[model samples]
Target chain A: MRNRLVVQLVDFDLAAEYRRLCELDGAVGAVVTFCGLVRDCEQQAPIDSLTLQHYPGMTEASLGDIVASADRRWPLHGITIIHRVGELLPRDQIVFVGVASGHRAAAFQAADYLMDYLKTRAMFWKNVAHGGERQWVDCKDSDRQAAHRWSQDPKRQ
Target chain B: MIKLLFFGRLGDATYAAPEVFEASVGLTAAGVRDALSSLYPALGRALFEPQVLVSVDRVIVDWQQPLLDGCELAFLPPVTGG
Candidate 1:
């Protein structure tokens, strides 16, 4: 699979990443992308800033594993994953996941699967700056459920 | 000797990143945990928590996985990334 996995402290160009995948192969028919941003509010409180931490070596390796899992389930021609670390503010882009495939269904499903897997599998932590303090964000039950769905679905298996 | 690394909240708790431990062959990750707990009670409590995870050479592994002499073990908190 043609895949790009990047973990950096720099911002990414979403359009450029998507365009690059589209250019990689003429057979590409569909491209699906997801960009995660730091939201302004959490639990009704205004978040002042955000910081992302990661286990550097494991972060890239784990992301590659997630992309590989998506490739196993879908006919993806290309995939791009970029996650940013360091201090960030509300509305800042935190992540990007894109998939290119010969059909729309594969592109969509693979992108969705990559996001779900990355949320749980990748070794990154998020800390929110709120009310003169910073605290680590707790893992949401919904994310675990979302990632688990891929394992339980016989069609994907 | 083996390198025991900590990341995320676990790193904050220990106030250390990669702590080292002298080990013999066939020592399991659980044994290392036991040693750490004995050496640093705070780390012991934090590590024994249900959410804490262990990785051998950067890949997540069970606590029962045996530690090699020069392996790097990492303690990871629950992930919160997208």
Candidate 2:
């Protein structure tokens, strides 16, 4: 019935989030979704706690831009992009972006597109300070590989 | 001159971002990186090359752009999203 884009930085609430995404998809004949949560371990590093950073104004703009990109490409009934910021403990919800569309294909594509751009383009950054001494996690090459797959022209093998 | 900011571990790694910098009037984010490299010789090893991410006014800049006055520039490591 409607289209929406939601982005936020809270302690992260799961049950409420499921409700929010659920509420937005009344028109969708089919809805496919995903949720990303914080794990106890990261890249062989013990992440006792995490603090997410973002450029406030820029963060919202980046979200809007991604939403716009999706709008430009496909027709979807609803969209939800909620990413957590601030100090987060292990097992906390790191981020989630769910899309609802008329069919399975659009929903899946929208969700994948959102995640790809979020990794490459979002202004948000993560800092993992271990219990003993804090360490800043580096952006991994794998993320680049994942994001690169969405480029306009994929390298022909 | 370009004024840059820092955050999180990226800030800690650079001993925190410089409050201000006297940079060339019009330069790209690449120029900002070079300026920071020259200014903070201590970070030459960790910050040089094309690995650093630069932001203008909090938005990451795709290199090959010009810097503006009072623009807040940022040097970020490859991002692990927040």
Candidate 3:
């Protein structure tokens, strides 16, 4: 099985996750992954940190739904999904999506698709600590645009 | 009646959740926006031409939503996540 999904409140062990993903090998020749880091900049505000929160039971279900969507959309051999909730500082990893496939194309595209959808369609939001103050933020227009492009009937192959 | 709620800057300017007198009209989102613009003049300055969008039921919605009675509408700004 090449699918692994995790939605945890604790800090994820990156090394263990990397190991579990590589344990199975079939059609996978390459595994590509991306981990998003909380940065100090958010639309020009000097962000101190962020507390990402979600509707617990529903968030995992949604992550599973998204990973399944990617599997149907791309031919893949292995997949790993991890997301972080609770407070995080700058440079702290917030999310990770990795995919393994027969070739680089599947891995690359699926990773991108997962993130694009996660940024927009996912029901996670943040209580952002910016410039000594905190507030909530909605999904970015770029993320929406990225999601809109995902439905391009031609790219699913 | 439904509330077209706002948060952050939108909330601060209006100082409360701005209400539309015809919120009970079962209006389309676009229509609700127009109602707010007319009823709360400040909403016209703050939200009439916003750099942001709205989300309903935790998902990005189009200008049209088949809102039934008692649907809590949430107005949101663009999200920035790591």
Best by lDDT: 1
Across A1-157, the per-residue lDDT of candidate 3 in tens digits comes to 5688776667777777766666667556778888888878877888888887664454676677888899898878778888888888988888988888888888889999899888875546777787677777766777888878878757554
Candidate 1, superposed: residue stretches over 4 Å from native: B13-18
- Cα deviation of A45, candidate 1, in Å: 1.7
Q: State the displacement of the C-alpha of residue A52, model 1, in Å, after optimal TM-score superposition.
A: 1.3
On residues A66-142, what C-alpha lDDT tens digit does candidate 1 reach at each position? 87788788888999999999999999999999999999999988888888888888989988889898888888999
* Least well predicted 10-residue stretch by lDDT in candidate 2 chain A: A148-157
lDDT of 3 at A87: 85
**lDDT for position A137 in model 3:** 71
What DockQ would candidate 3 receive versus the native complex? 0.21
Tell me which residue pairs clash in candidate 3.
Answer: A138-B78, A138-B79, A139-B79
**CA error at residue B57 for candidate 2, angstroms:** 2.4
Better of 1 and 2 by lDDT: 1
> How do the candidates score on chain B by TM-score?
0.88, 0.68, 0.70
TM-score for candidate 3: 0.67
Docking class of 3: incorrect
Q: Give the Å error, residue A91, model 1.
A: 0.8
Error of 3 at A59 (Å): 0.8
Error of 3 at A146 (Å): 0.9
The TM-score of candidate 1 is 0.92
